[model samples]
Target: MSQNHTWLEIRELAEALYCSVKSVYIYRDKNLFKAGTHYYSVGEGKLRGKHIYNLELCRKALLERTAKDSRSNETYDNKEINKLMTRKLDNKNLSYRK
Candidate 1:
């Protein structure tokens, strides 16, 4: 919402953001820096103007961001079910038929 004191350097930014600088670096490295700002490289690996953070973006990122990702690896044999069901009926049709 209000982020008058939102613009901050690395440590301050991390503190205000309630996250670690390392996490910030991790996000930055992963290109997951969803803080709604374009990074303008300061120089020699330093960055500036990264404090364009806002509550909306932070909330969205926090809500959407996952701490640990679960890779979808479940391989199911749907061909059999598809063969039996075909496109003839939906779940409701099957249930109603019962």
Candidate 2:
């Protein structure tokens, strides 16, 4: 993901990851990702809180979890996932892009 990209809301992240919002919450509870690293909470109203995820860190967390799960036969090509995530972030002014 590019530096210019904005934080992703939980719903946006769920959509990007092709998972349900509940699954995202489950992943959080399971410690698949950590707060302030993979995600952070935002104030919605006077007392309401909402979550926003860091796209790059979320991708990193998923990669790490997949690496540590020896019993899982699922295989992921990280390059492809990275490309897709970067595209979803949609940062148009990336420095490396000419």
Off by over 4 Å in 2: 1-6, 44-48, 71-98
lDDT of 2 by residue, 1-98 (tens): 64754579989998888888898899899988688778888775656478888776877788788787865776569998888777755467655835
**Model 1 CA lDDT for position 29:** 69
- List RMSD in Å for every model shown: 11.5, 18.0
- Candidate 1: tens digits of C-alpha lDDT, residues 1-98: 85653444567656766888887677666866644462333335445434444434553555556532433444447897778677576556664433
Each candidate structure's TM-score, on Cα atoms with residue i matched to residue i, is 0.41, 0.59
Best by TM-score: 2
Model 2 quality (TM-score): 0.59
Please report how far candidate 2 places residue 25 from its true position, in Å: 0.1
| Backbone clashes under 3 angstroms, per model | 0, 0
